[model samples]
Target: MSLPLPAPVSTYFEISNGSDIAQVTRCFTDDALVVDEGQAYRGHAAIQSWQRDAQKKFAYSVEPVGLSRNGDRLTVTASVVGSFPGSPVQLYHVFDLAGDRIRSLEIG
Candidate 1:
């Protein structure tokens, strides 16, 4: 599915699917915060580390299937397929954008 997303948001999915751990940090702000699996990662370094760790632990790809907005926040419903316990599952990715970058992202 293709959605008309902001540049930073679109870059996010692209880089994520590419699995380039190094480049993933460029999609966010220097002080961006990410929350996933009940843990919060603050700043680019932490977020990068989080992504690297996750990539090492699981092989997954997410396709954004739906989008919604409330104020400046975006909620993306994505279809995830991976080698994890749940081979396929729908997940929510809530993003907060800052200028042309993502200020924060929470995935559950």
Candidate 2:
């Protein structure tokens, strides 16, 4: 039997593994909003800046462990590893999808 795959997990992997700003930008809407650690970044420009800054500060990888969806919203539990003291961080991502792109993403 074929196992069912999780959409959010697949999308998360695609976006996380993508190093190109243009390719990653394609995963989000034109006016997408991303919130992380109480900071909110709106639009592609801000998103790209945030990604660049993050890459500079932390060398990490995101591994999705669980996923759930409710209508246009998707929630994912991921394991994050970086250069910080507590190198590994467990994060929850809440994604709001509009069609094939993500309209908003909140992380905690």
Candidate 3:
């Protein structure tokens, strides 16, 4: 069964799985922040570049398996498979939403 996700989170996974970098960037707020691999990307331009770079660096697919909420924060646990070292891994995608857009996202 699929967990019910917030609009921004749902749209994020949709564009991410489709490898639509441009649309993915639009899923966040203007001053959005994304942290992946301990690296921080602030603002749209940085996030856009990060997505583009990551898309080129890996061929991956994510399947959201679970979710949890804490006030305005929503955490999605997803199974990811890709060309990276680990064939399959469970990742926590923690999101902080502001209004209809995502204010920050951290992938671990």
Best by TM-score: 3
**Candidate 2 whole-model C-alpha lDDT, 0 to 1:** 0.75
Ranking by lDDT: 3, 1, 2
Q: lDDT value for candidate 3?
A: 0.87
- Give the least accurate 10-residue stretch of model 2, judged by summed lDDT: 1-10
* Residue ranges of candidate 1 with Cα displaced over 4 Å: none
The order by descending TM-score is: 3, 1, 2
* Per-residue accuracy of model 3 over 1-108 as CA lDDT, tens digit each: 577888888888876676566775557998999999999999988888887787789998889999999998999999989999977999999999998899999999
lDDT of 1 by residue, 19-80 (tens): 56666566899889899999999987887788778778888988999999987799999998
Off by over 4 Å in 3: none
Model 1 lDDT-worst window of ten = 16-25
Return the TM-score for candidate 1, rounded to 2 decimals: 0.91
lDDT of each: 0.86, 0.75, 0.87
Q: What TM-score would each prediction reach against the true structure?
A: 0.91, 0.85, 0.92
RMSD for each of the candidates: 1.3, 3.1, 1.3
Question: In terms of lDDT, which candidate is strongest?
Answer: 3
Error of 2 at 98 (Å): 0.3
* Model 2 lDDT at residue 2: 19
